[model samples]
Target: MSERNYRAAIIGTGAIAHAHARALQDAAGRVSLVAVADVDAGRAGEFAAGYGRARAYGSAEELLRAEELDFVHLCTPPRLHAPLAVTCLEAGVTALVEKPPTLSLAEFDTLIEAERRTGAYVATVLQHRFGPGAVRLRRLQEAGELGRTLLATCATQWYRDEAYYAVPWRGTWESEGGGPTMGHGIHQFDLLLSVLGPWSEITAVAGRQARSVETEDVSMALVTFENGALAAVVNSVVSPRQTSELRFDCERGTVEVEHLYGYTDDDWTVTPAPGHEDVQALWVKDRSEESSGHASWLAAVLDALDQGQAPPVTTADARRTMEFIAALYASAFTGERVRSGQITADSPFAQRMDGTGARWRNA
Candidate 1:
């Protein structure tokens, strides 16, 4: 809110925190990383040393009280997101949280309320939607170049071995939320929802077929968008050959992107109708060279700071994605179709997503 480099801090010194640091570093003149905090002071110190000017803290409370940060990145696990973000908002600082922003829709609503109470804002890390290809596709779809969407697919098929699940939070519903659906597949599906807009209905089935986790390791859903397009969504951790894919079958042609974690212009391909080779030209023109990643999204966040507005993946957008996660679980466990906005504050699925509750156990 001042005429200075926007002060920032990272709350967790974990795997994703490294990306946040690199992204902040890349935005050198636009922002500064003033502090780093973690349960392990050594890890925080190590992260601070890597960034030069950053101070290290043993806890987020220390970082918040000591530093006058404009924003903080909640890179901690899923469960800590709402608490950390609420803490930042209460301290008059904006927050940029990592994906699967909260454990459930109820927690997410708490965040929405916090942002309302505080003037500060919150943005979730959905880097895929910031890519040039995604931007181009959304523009193309809007301009009627893609024509009416008929069907689509969003698949996040990633391989996580037994050792990976050994992490206490990896497979648990309370810690990491849901498995591939909430943790891994969220990116592609968020991007899918971005392209398709509001979803009306979802019918899904989730199963703990392979993983020893308390939640579903694999799930599939049929989604009906408000635009009249239909989609088949799949989330899985058991696939040996991992890939992140989203394909849209539209009236003009098919737009597809295939990648693992992130996407570049190279990963996006447009298969236009027989006489529509020029469609690809229109799609590729005026495209940003950077791929879909934290750096790009961070730039957008910093830019929004200059403009005095909440960044992309705001609560409303994040809620749609989070609501879909709820709907996925609600439909998967319950043998009924779930509509948007069904998982309210009073619902058991909104409170906690494990299969031990009424709607879940009845399935």
Candidate 2:
């Protein structure tokens, strides 16, 4: 990495933009915030002024055209991620986009095409993978400390009021893609995918039980991993009491994390079985302390760029996560066990999440 600061810019000054700005600020002397943009001119100007002495633009196109940046952090809605990242790649600038990188596999392929043609890298913001807690678990499992992963569970149950969905792109298929699974639970589920690696098949169900929206408000799936491990996954936006949790039952014992949005060391707990108490000591020995969030992900992305390597959560890895999402929706709506590769480019589910485009037409 160069001793001199690498220039960085931010697009979209929404809630997530603030987190990106703070991460940049937290990065201190490593990266310099060069510019920021939003459709709302005032928001862009304010974000730039508050974060750094960055120039502000009214749109991402303007931001890209005017700056010579090393990378751009895309904090936009799900619908715009593909095109915006494609624009960045085409301009020879790398892109770090938020999770559920695109609406569908077909859409993600467009970004892949642009990347191959442009020679610029595109990384998805699956921040949970970069966290210390999960990192520790991955290392232990690889060393045969945790033994084989036997059973795992991920649940993202949170509440959203009417006003929350009132935003133009809240819970629509055309805009935000899918509901809890795509938008909310994505962080936790992506973390699950990282731990288990590739998935094989899924049988799932989804429904729009409470929210008056176009997509499912809740979903449940049984995922089979390549290593012969099984998982039960649930995503919900209508729960009254919200919690984000993941539990891994390995050959030694069980390792779990319980938190709402983000987590720290306190939220993680490891239990060793009767004969494998050493697993608990190894877990407490040494690992990163930084909680998973925008800052940690940004650090990894910046470090990768400095080393002239592709950053974390590359498109191909992110595809597996997105494919799992598509398969779940396909299985839920079509009443079939959707295999990992079943949602292909020609699959109707790949075009639109509903497959048959029946449910939530008016949601």
Candidate 3:
């Protein structure tokens, strides 16, 4: 259990698989990439070749059966995440699943069930929260430098060229689970929810404005937080410059964070309330090196495994983020406000998310 060295496996050999590999390497003495598995033997072999002394498997089942892994990094598409993750946990391997844990609420529930049954620690990779800018923002909030937060807004406008969605499962509801909202927006929303707790209700609309995908390439949502703070989220794959930004309006000041997915500089200002000159003295310049977000989170996963504890981001916590998306879809289609608590196992929308529908036809 010493942090000096630990063994880990990666479940998928896709693009994100390389990111996980880098994270393992980044941890250096603390952890090592022990093995890798992919549905395609060629890809698995290629991945194994890049990392030093890694065993390769043609599939996850084979890898799990043959090797002892301290943790598994799952980089498969959204739909395949649950079953594979459960398999790892049930087999006594810890896991760090990529963003947007699963395709639907039901799948997320199964992940939780598997965790309960096995006591395997499963963490969701919402790496944005690890950014230095975000850390600074949290410190400010904790110190009450921002005062009462009234509203927050996040926008992710990034281009996904035709070739980007050319892959069979790229833009589909069945595999990838919708468009940028689930793919790109999930990261920003993760940070939002991390700072501001669970939302009370959400109303949203999604449409296919540009892409050939069955699901919407553009989506918008209006959220009412449990703390009564208002929020708006917009995600699109049609924009040109690829802008990621967040703005907060608070009683004493305003803070704006720029750069959609990477490290960013947070610009903030303070306006003291009347007769509060002494409080103004607390303000200080906030600046720090941006984080290689996902790498930082993966390091935490390794540390957690070494200590026999749960990572900061857990499967149950991720389920709520998925519920936020499900509730948004329900409200959009029904033309009624949707409460997060209303999306239980017995909810009407629960059965319809079969991971396949007209929404995936174009994708």
Which candidate, 2 or 3, has the higher TM-score? 2
Model 3 lDDT tens row, 81-196: 87888999999988788876877788788888888999887888888877766776677777877676789998988898889888888887678766787788888887888777
Number of the predicted model whose TM-score against the real structure is largest: 2
Q: Tens digit of lDDT per residue, candidate 1, span 1-363? A: 345588889999999999989998888888899899999999899989988879999999999999988899999988899999999999999999998899988889999999999988988999999988998899889999988999999999989888999988888777998888989999999999999999999999888777676777889999999999999999999999999999999888899999998889989888888887778788777866688989989888877878888988899999989889888888877778999888877887887765344233334
lDDT of 2 by residue, 215-282 (tens): 88999999999999999999998998999999999999899999998888778999998999998889
Show where candidate 2 strays beyond 4 Å. 358-363
Candidates, ranked, lDDT:
2, 1, 3
Query: Which candidate would rank higher by TM-score, 1 or 3?
Result: 1
- Superposed model 3: Cα runs more than 4 Å off: 1-4, 264-286, 352-363
What is the lDDT for 251 in model 3? 74
lDDT measured at residue 311 in model 2 versus the true structure, 0 to 100: 92
> Model 1: how far is 299 from its true place, Å?
1.0
lDDT of 2: 0.89
* Alpha-carbon runs more than 4 Å astray in model 1: 1-4, 355-363
TM-score of each: 0.96, 0.97, 0.90
Candidate 2: the clashing residue pairs are: 213-363, 214-363
TM-score of 3: 0.90
